[model samples]
Target: MQDNGPSLVCAPPAADARSGIVLGEDALTVADAARFAREPGDVPIAIGEDAALRMDASVAARDRLILMRRPIYGVTTGFGDSARFHLSPEKTTELQRNLIKYHLNGTGPSAPVDVVRAAMLVRANCLARGYSGIRRGVVELIVDCLRHGITPVIPERGSVGASGDLVPLCYLADLLMGSGTARVDGEPVPAAVALRSRGLDPVAFEAKEGLALINGTSFMSGFGVLAVHDAEGLCAVADLGTALAAEALMGNRSHFEPVIHRQKPHPGQVRSAARVRALVRGSDLCLDTPQVLEANPDVDGLGVIPLGRPIQDRYSVRCAPHVNGVLADTLDWVRRWLDIEINSTNDNPLFDFATGRVHNGGNFYGGHVGQAMDSLKLAVASVGDLLDRQLAMLVDTKFNHGLPPNLVRRVDPGDPAAGLHHGFKGMQIAASALAAEALKLTNPATAFSRSTEAHNQDKVSMGTIAARDARSVVELVTEIAAIHLLAGCQAADLRGAHLLGLGTRTGYEVIRDHVPFVDHDRRLDEDLGVVVGLIRSGALVAALRPHWDADV
Candidate 1:
């Protein structure tokens, strides 16, 4: 649970990797953000040579719009409501600088370092395609910041998820220009000092470079990608946790039989049922025969009596697969959107200078990412709600079969408070509080919108809020799962040394490693924290992957 081993390292990238994209299948399992903050390799940033040549030829064919008289949206005019303001060629560079400086209004707590790094990576990748018309030097600055661990202090709020996450990204652009602030080697410093310390000069804005830098959905998309990736892990853990819960409860495995799954055959439901069956396969308690006795013939006739608590367990234990299976299905939907978002070109007013054409488009709207992230948060919260219910069942005497109340300590009747002690009262309370917070955070932020900046952003997508909410939900879900694991392990121990399935055994081993059984209810919050840490570090996933694969 509390692994004191060395931290997981970042393994080398595979040979067939592309520039700026860290492929997940072959990449090292990054357990912490510090691993990603280290300098990356020399991935080149190149202009689209083929597209540039075509654009050059197209520019040659157009003499009607001469260089001195030509006008471009961001190139020769102010942005948004000020688009009517035209500028001479001499003022274009100054205009770009002014654009970045004026829009730096992002406020709130800074995002986690990894998210900042991810945003940098997303922005760099978008620029690498060479459609934004920015010089290669500008893109390289973003790459350098990421490589050298000089992440700009980007606030978490103030993004409309349209018009390219303007306010939030301006904070990043401003730092690159040596005019804002950034975190250098985990210490806050002036942007100018941070850049200078790295022997890098702040980049000056060019014709369309400022607009290109700030006019994109990198903020929302980057956070969404991170949230969705973490949600996938949570979904997997939810399945594993549900299976372990079923095993601890000695619930009917018939519900997960192949025949039962074949009749309906929803993919998530079938997969969840199969996983539960595998985890309960070698469980001796699950296979134990029910005790039966014939009633006495003395009074009234005779009746057969069934024993061993009851024939069926409570719904929390019996219905876990169905509850967690829905989350698995929701994750599948979120993954599709994330895949498309990561590969999308979301900059607005795309240019084809070679063909002498420009297309203003809806690429700036973040509806896709916003909706996906909103759904992901709700799904993860639902998992937390399910886990909370299961944990309650594990601790409540009514549902715990013959186990001790709250799994507490028992002693001789003569000694009331001597050897007798209470059990997971504090832990159950913590679980309830955490579940309440998770439910409170379930209100989808994407559905709330307000016009701002003189109604220029009349219809907004609060994708940033959705992402932040999802992150909070992830923490709450991890805490709830920790409580469930602690309680389930206790329940299993109380039921005697019955052989458990591979997955449940691994989970028990994880708990035994750090927090021992609750002989007495000492401080439980500390133990819960340890379990939460283990879950967050992917220790559970690594331990259970072998068992999961063997079953399939």
Candidate 2:
């Protein structure tokens, strides 16, 4: 069956040949995952010298345990409910094979190719930590799969976020053994065909290799990494969208003053204010509130003093820093946690070569990932609601400070009224609908944990579900931001975009390049697609990058 998830467009890894990442040595950052997702490539991935030695030592320990007939979990014994049923040494290899085959029951759609690739990278990183007692060949096989773009078609469901995403990860282990399906350059084919065409053969598993490969937090980590990276980009996009809307609304720039932010002393608020201030810097359209200009007579007659603007813009416009600042702060917290998670070994029964012992622990639990994702979804949904409000304000003349109703550009100036043209009328509705859906998904996924596996797998972390929800919220917000971006650009043009701030001007021009000013009532569906592509393609984010840096 064909896998229908979005195909990842391969981009080069952020690190070059000299600075490339080495498995089990260099740390993997969320940004690295983002770069790898965009451009999947064959970067150098080898077991580190020290890690390899440790791996050898670990394998020796496992062998000794097997010789002594030690009752090891998933090694010399059955799994889960059958843990008491011991396996003979001769049947260990067959037990490992059966472990993977029985868990090949993942339901639901396949994850996106980028997610699968990220999962592969994360899983390989964990194994390369020299704790899983796996052979170097197993690590090399995973690397080759990623290097060749052979993304296993793992289902989106069947993980309870405990015992480390076992069901979905089984598909990955199955693919390495050439028994499942994989996507070769986005085309689905039999895993055996994909592997053989690349001059590779299916791997034969040893006693504990299959369990080590299929157990751990790779799936959740992959989704969480992508969500965090996308959230970072979305926060920047929020700043850009709001900056343009501020220019269009002729909003008071005094609200973002450093002194006011200093009084509050929130790092995120300060950064957010500074970012917006930098974006609107050098713009003639940005006005000070009468109270602000009046209070400061030093520069009273300095700028193009606009008259009849409100004493204070609405909360959506004036309180943008507070909202987007919360987003910035949330990202800071999430990144801090993910940095540790993406690098740490999250498997069970970690073999300590130095101690010559196997340690069983709950490192496989995904509660940390779950908590981060749950909080992240709320932040993402809040931004979605913020953008939804901004989009609404841009479409209504009452709130838009004299921009045309629904932001309809006037073509025939003599027509006096362009009653037939209703611009962004339905677009605003779409934005609201998306925002509502995102908000509805904000219910904590961790609260719905279910017990399974004969009560052995009780209190499973629903971190995977939370991560998926965060990803969905990010996607929805990206759409809403696209609508607001298009409308903000149109409003900027109608209001004489020359008055826009430096960064806002660049953003406006970029939007105008792809989606022209909507002068008449026309279907904005295609325009939305163009703008969404620009946002998702990172053009909008890149355009706004300098402003944030300058502020910093």
Candidate 3:
């Protein structure tokens, strides 16, 4: 359905929010889902009339099959092991209700409200494809729940990522019937109470409605959408971080030369090199190695500079493009895969309109998402490693060129607080600890597969867990990025602000706007928080968006 109709007034408080995205049998990109998920106000959603009509047609086909007693799966028969048991037509409603009730076994802390909302939106989109045999009224209720801020309190655990995300989805199904808990305006309450407060009614399960609502990959897809979005933002910020670190270390920009990159021509590497070049352009802090060598050549005339100030920068300073470039490429790949998954119809017994038959199969397996998330975790953790290494370099006198030890401003030796004032010493340690945690979370989710549901659902994909792990990894890495930004700015200050590149100079000023130069040691917790907020808020990335366009 084309999403161009007037939206229903689902909630007065949220009524004036952005106009709803119409859920039809069309593409719902990952970026689109992320935007809708992160909307500050409740973004309204509407069912497309064309989608409703298509769904009505599929519903009619299901009704015909039921009247013929064609013995369809999940419609006339029980689910899973009970698929062998045929049910009478009168028991169809009970069968659907029982399907949801039995699968309400999810257990863990509640998923974030945004994740829940995204999941609902994804599921609604899947149903709108008109292949799930669900009625338009059911789709409206899903949209109503999201618009009125009625998010189901879904648990974080359960589900093998095969046969759909059944456990959490059952909670969603339970909420539709007003039998579970929900969050309204960020407060937990009975689902029925929340719905009633919004002038809404609960729905009773019909023939295929229960199965249609619960049988899909919405939970995993929702997490993937947000994770991919954040990963993209992180890559941009990582570029800023690398630029700041490069300038602070007085590292040579020779490594980012196009001549060196053209030989490899990896798209991500070329892009990363370009961003670093742009970010560090016009920076006086970077070493002019060619000029230095020209002025002081070796006595043997090998075209080499004298062995002073070291011939080259350390690996952390020189190999940043190689490290961050791979991460950039990985994020781009995962985004493409998520774009396909978010728009896909991942439910079983799909109604094939052209063939006029229910094609029952395992289109719901989340192996692709599982692998993408696993790959994402590894890449994000590597970013943590890169940032950690750079932070360590910034604090140490041995590798920081001529910067003061621990990045402390050179104080009077006779001053009483000379040795006591340790600048960025504690901040570097905190960054290290966070990097360690992030690296430890790189375990692959596909390695933890388990058999469940009477062996009928054995060897299921642990994609949800993988996606959650990737989220945690992203969080830790963001903190690490914050620490790097803080330390890099401090190092830049010691080196002289006038020496910084155009983009890095602007970034340095942005950091100092919230946090001042550390003349003496002070509590850095608040400073770290402000920087992290800036990163997560996308402000830092946006400030340098022009510099990052090449990387994107």
Task: Give the CA lDDT, 0 to 100, for residue 153 in model 3.
Answer: 93
Candidate 1 lDDT over 209-244, as tens digits, reads: 788778887787667666666666676677667766
lDDT, candidate 3, 7-45, per-residue tens: 311211212235556676455677778878887354556
Give each model a TM-score: 0.86, 0.92, 0.93
Count of steric clashes across candidates, in order: 1, 3, 2
Off by over 4 Å in 1: 1-68, 288-309, 416-420
The true-versus-predicted C-alpha distance at residue 457 of model 1, in Å, is: 2.0
Residue-level lDDT of model 2, residues 1-552, one tens digit each, is 011112311222334455766666436677776677667774555555655565677788788888888888889889877888887888888998999999989888889998888888888877876778888788889888888889899999989888889999999999989998999999999999999999987888997899898778889988998998888888888888888888888788888889999998778889888888889998888776665455444535677555454667788878888988888899898988887776667777777766678888777788889999999999889988998998898889778878888888765666865477888898999999999999999999999999999988888998888888898999999899999998888888888989899989988888888888887777888999998888777888798878779666
Local error of candidate 1 at residue 138 (angstroms): 1.3
lDDT of 3 at 380: 86
